[model samples]
Target: MKKSYCPIDTFINVIKGKRKSTIILHLFQGNKRYNELVKLIPDISERMMSKQLKELETDNLINREVFPEVPPRVEYSLTDLGKEIHPYLKGMFKGGIIFENKIDSEEN
Candidate 1:
């Protein structure tokens, strides 16, 4: 199917959305259960968080594991592609601050 987006644009779109980048950031630190992510990014609604996670999984950036247990255990971690892509996350990490603070600005 011909997409209405450039290949690069399509690639960026997969990661640029509601909260996909933030969720990936949390996972980059280490593997986490779904609840841990919710706690880390409190502003995100549960529905939104789940949706973002699924998108990342589809993009091959994350791996979701489900364990069969009485309480139903589930965990999420980054895939090899995630490690490759994490460097880009830094752009989001240091966004405004990178240019917002002037080199000569002196503020305590």
Candidate 2:
């Protein structure tokens, strides 16, 4: 991530990819496998999901563990930094809901 004078910009830059925040929030629940993430976030294409996961891992926001078997199994979980950011993300989630409601009311 690029250095920024504004801390918020740094935060945004780290989580600034398609469904990146969504992936972090889901992983906050618990560890998830690749297929489970796909199911959880059906709107994201498999290619995009892979890209986002790699980026998150690079940013140290999530952990990717691979288990060897007949077929390799990969799981994702939040790292300490990822967990630390959850409250901020939840605040943003709440703020989004408030804005959505305001928009709906304005349209009505």
Candidate 3:
């Protein structure tokens, strides 16, 4: 695979998908089951959610635990690295809100 030269590019690559940051933000609240995450993010399809979760797992930002049960329950939580980046992700979320409000005000 081609390597990214800049640290920012590398970081961005991990969270590039539309739902990645949203997933992280939700996990920041606490560990969640697959269905719970799907419920929290209304617009995302199950297939896309699975894809993003797999990518996040590959990046070491989230942990997936499979329970030994008849139904095979699965839960995801943030890793230490993911916890560390929570503030930055939160900041981006706030900035997005500000940006949207600014644009709305400008249109009036």
Candidate 4:
């Protein structure tokens, strides 16, 4: 947990899992319902989504809030620590898009 330790590896340990990083990145914008995340990442199965969300929550990268109502509701959003990753995530996404586009163009 200390920055003096192997912080980069620790960070990667939390972020590098499949669907985990993307879920956190998407949550950087705002709170999202479980259904919303599934809709956005349609290729992911419901079971996988639930698993990823649980992992992120365990890592303290996300908040899992449940509301009381006739029909219960749950929403997820980035924790403050997770919000701190926003700038980096944005840079990664922007650069990844450009890189992918270049590869596509080269292949054609």
Best by lDDT: 2
lDDT pick, better of 1 and 4: 4
- Evaluated at residue 8, the lDDT of candidate 2 is 90
User: How do these models rank on lDDT, best leading?
Assistant: 2, 3, 4, 1
Looking at model 3, how many pairs of residues clash?
A: 0
lDDT of 2 at 68: 88
Report the C-alpha lDDT of model 1 over 4-57, residue by residue, as the tens digit. Answer: 468867667778868787888888999999999999999989999898888889
lDDT against the true structure, per candidate, is: 0.83, 0.95, 0.91, 0.84
Number of the top-ranking candidate, with TM-score as the measure: 2
Q: How do the residues 1-108 of candidate 2 rate in per-residue lDDT, one tens digit apiece?
A: 678899999999999889999999999999999999999999999999999999999999999999988689999999999999999999999999999999999999
What would the C-alpha RMSD of candidate 3 be, to one decimal place? 1.5
Q: How many clashes would you count in candidate 2?
A: 0
Q: Over 4 Å off in model 2, which ranges?
A: none
TM-scores of the candidates in the order shown: 0.81, 0.97, 0.93, 0.85
**Candidate 3 structure quality by residue, lDDT tens digits, 15-107:** 889699999999999999999999999999999999999989988899999999999999999999999988988888999999999999999
Query: Alpha-carbon error at 25 in model 1, in Å?
Result: 1.3
Per-residue error for 75 in candidate 1, Å, reads: 0.5
Evaluation by lDDT, superior candidate among 1 and 2: 2
